[model samples]
Target: MIDEPEPRRQTPQELRGLVGSANIPTLLMVIYQVTRDERWLRPPYLPTRSKGLGDHDSGGLPEPVQEEIRAAGVRALLDLQDGRAPAIALPDPEQTRRMLEACVGEPVDRSYGEMFAREFRRRAGADDGPARPVRGGSDLRVLVIGAGVSGIIAAHRLERMGVSYLVVDKHDAPGGNWLDNRYPGAGVDTPSHLYSFSFAPRDWTQHFELRGELERYFADTFDRIGARPRTRFGTEVVRAEFDEGRQLWDVELRDSDGLRESISVNAIVSAVGILNRPFVPALPGLELFGGPSFHSSEWNDDLDVTGKRVAVIGSGASAMQIVPAIAPSVRGLTVFQRTPPWVAPFEKFQQPIDPGARYLLRTFPLYRTWYWLKLYWQFGDKVLDALRKDPDWPHPERAVNARNDGHREFFTQYIRDELAGREDLFGKVVPDYPPFGKRILLDNGWYRALCRPNVELVNEAVTSVVEGGVVSSSGAVHEADVLVWATGFTASRFVSSLEIIGRDGQSLREAWDDDDARAYLGVTVPGFPNLFLLGGPNSFPGSGSFMHFMEVQMRYVGRLLTCMFDLDIRAIDVRKDVFDEYAELVDRTSATTVWTHPGTDTFFRNSRGRLVFVSPFRNVEYWTRAQSAGLEDYEIVAAP
Candidate 1:
């Protein structure tokens, strides 16, 4: 008898999931490296003495390069939202390329092109075959702009559905926020395990993941789903026009090579998230500061800060992470705070996943699914009730209303308990805003860093950046050798920097006008029929993993593709009435949540003082709403 195929022997590392190609593993390594998570394999991915993001120039640029840098910085100081400054001149492009090559090793080539082409032919709707008639005039056409998480997810879903789609990204790759924000402590606030796709659960070694790991996750996502072939790297969507006459979208793309190309598609999806653009605060004498300074999102990686005295502005999530991560290394750290933040107690924020749990998750995907589900409800949906305004509860300043008041007391006690002995810091750390009013920051050594002897948390708002340091409005000048602005991205305004035009010569900026950024089910717009949006307004989840929400939107887009196939519709635009109705529902729901609490300031609200980005409903409600599209929700156009 032929010997039965020998049972596959799994490596020890494989069994432990220490080695893998998934996103979470890399994320685990990153968190472990940065935070020294004892549970993970010791010594995470560490680069030998390199420039961190927001590093200032150390007088090493040529005259021309230096001039360009000065010009960009001056322009940014003048107008925060004008455009992204060009990357500072590197140590010669070829030399930098060589260094990168040495670091990552020789590039590995994969045949995604052939894979995508084959899958397209095999799964393309009914008209895939040579004899099949072109019922809708073209075979499986889709357009996706923005190469961030949402963009990647949309492309993956389209690929899975065998749709012929082009994904355009201004950046070199995916991972939106991850790609853009590369500050010293740049990492995910959520646990890496829960912050990933349901279809691609990873054996992450730690809870919070760092930037490199997140980027790898995006790379692995394309590798897993075979979506790379349909992507145009280093290409930006300058204009997207809706052609009502042909039921198509005309997209004008510009690449790094300076080549301009216009393509037509039956549908368009804007995957560019609101957080892609950096928002630097405007302050007097900001340009006059001769020392190093830059936004947290657009981190400069050449200026060294090993022994420099640092001044960090904006005590938000990024600020919190930046302060703690750089505290141990910097000579002195001065953190500027506009308002104290409510510190929620999360024990696992800086910890690693248990070994037993890792085994179950990696070996059995069901366990992972169950864990994600538990997180979905525990973190995502459950908070909706907690955020509801509690009319009966006491304590107004600590918490605005009742349900909000209850949550505040619960979190305040948690913080009080954590800082039991340190009353001095407790007074400074405890936030006046109700819990969930702003983005609740996880404890990634922020509290512990505050207790450090070298770190100082300043509660005063900054008024100006002098030559030596920053002067607060309270007339205190804190001297520093280097300044780091951990202020976050320009949120609430969708695709503000990019110049995009839809049908009838309508610009996206004109349509949004910095406020009223709404879309149909946070995916489609009425006038821009063929255009779909991924992480558009009202789609951002207030709790849980943003990836979970992205997956839901991806699945929804996939279903739409299925409809395009089954119904043979060339295009479908959300009805204006339907979009308006959805926007009204979103507004009504948001008004009742803690997000609208009068006492707090957050990026979730627009200039009009209206909450435009976050979802007020529970995760299940959103999932159900996005699971399938109603015919009445959209106006479909059929081919003649």
Candidate 2:
């Protein structure tokens, strides 16, 4: 008889995972974390610092060195998985600081290192940390508005602290903009790992998740927090007036059907995100259009675009996503642009996770944690230096500094490469302004889509709407069967949906001067007691993880509540001087940033050319301050 064929041997799962891609430095850290091995942090295994989105898989190391790290990583991880070693080992603060520096190949400030460690420990159950209710939190009642990401964040914090709170939204479910914007190819520009909650969020299917998935994530997040049972859906808080005698807010609620109701609560947290409202420009003859017209926010999913002539007005984020998705199906397409936006290379646009890598991210705790840290470092505070303006640098018209100019050149070349043969499309698409001056868009084949023969890129503002077409400012008629207003939102209008009456019957609109909104640390106003604003004036880090900042804001809110409990206070409003000083500081610092570049017009500024929205502070600074802005900054009312 012939010798029986030997059955094929299967590699261990952890070893199988090792063959897939990884951030080598992150993997080294993970190995050290898993095995508590000193060799991983030593000279031979240390990584050479690399930049951009490249995996730098071998970490610019010799092949032998990479082989050893990967092999050791797999073995260490298996030990953890098989219960031979501790499940999630961590370094001492000093060693962690050393590892952080060694891994990144740069000196990390102790302040930032401390902040990083705190975030690692506190971020939504990154470990088995206790969640103790704030002292006196059980007695407090909170009214959270807009059950979007921000509102849901508040609910999660409140529930953890054993605080009584209710969330309200006009939409029937938890999603805010994600619920509203269902246009084709709607997704986040931020990376999936860094864009999520720190407290053990689910592994994402894509590098950057799209609308439907994001919507589901929010709904699921709310459900997980046990928030839905306490949420009043299809309800809008139209008015809120401070009752001096009661020392509480009297809130007016309007349902989706226009039915009204009222309630009172100890505190109000406005989770109404910055981009909640859609702005449809009042173009002349829009009513005269024979074809159907709609804003990009209220996308009609049922309407078919196949074989139809479509005109998308406004070459912003929404238009970028919509045009590419529908361009293939539409017979003809016209994109009206007022100004071209700076487009960045979306490294993993539409890229799916590798199976083995996904398995590791899901199964290995240390692997997931280190991967998140890698993303945060790569995408976060690192970009700020390039964004800071160098006033002495020449050619301020084209770029901010050498680094900023390099970004512009890279983006310009990216546009050129995408539309190589079509040189005529260059002038129309390449921006003249400095990079980061406007909101930077992810490429995602937008330039290639614009190069399509059937698509037309009109380099002018939409001045009017005709019977069957949109009229450009140059009087050019772009004929179409359908019209889409992707003009973005009225971002300058903060909290416009609610008519808030603060101390002495002062309307919030009047306090904000109708358009210019200001809040102390972008959460509290001087006159609004027991009131907090999420994503309020200057809170945004311009570009970063929205979820991270939302958590920080709510955590700050938690600290404020703790302060109240400590002081035996009933209500606390930001002191007027404190608010004004913060505003002054913001204005002064913002003036020196690339965001304030006059060469580009952006929603980051208000009508008066004031930088009203974007936060000028570094991520670390904001994170640190949010943890402790102090009770001294507030004017408090004594508890009964």
- Backbone clashes, each candidate: 7, 1
Q: Can you write out model 2's per-residue Cα lDDT over 276-385, one digit (the tens) per residue?
A: 68899887798999987999999888989899999999999999899999999999999999899888877789888776666666666666766666566666676676
RMSD in order of candidates:
17.8, 4.8
Distance from true position, residue 68, model 1, in Å? 68
Stretch of 10 with least lDDT, candidate 1: 47-56
State the number of backbone clashes in model 1. 7
Structural similarity to truth (TM-score) of each candidate:
0.77, 0.94
lDDT of 1 by residue, 1-640 (tens): 1123225544444433421222232222222223333433322221122111101112222445334333332332222122222132112323222222222222212221222222222222212223222334238688887777787777666665666778878788777678778888788877676677655556677767788877888788767777777788899877777777777777788889989988888777778788766677798889878788888876687767788899988888888778878888988889988888876665555566666455445553322433443344345544565676666657755665665666667777777777657788888877777787898877667887878888888888899888889999899999998888877777888867566666567877777775678887788776666677788888899887788688667666666666666677777767878888888998888887888888888899988888888887766567667754665677785433
lDDT of 1 at 262: 85
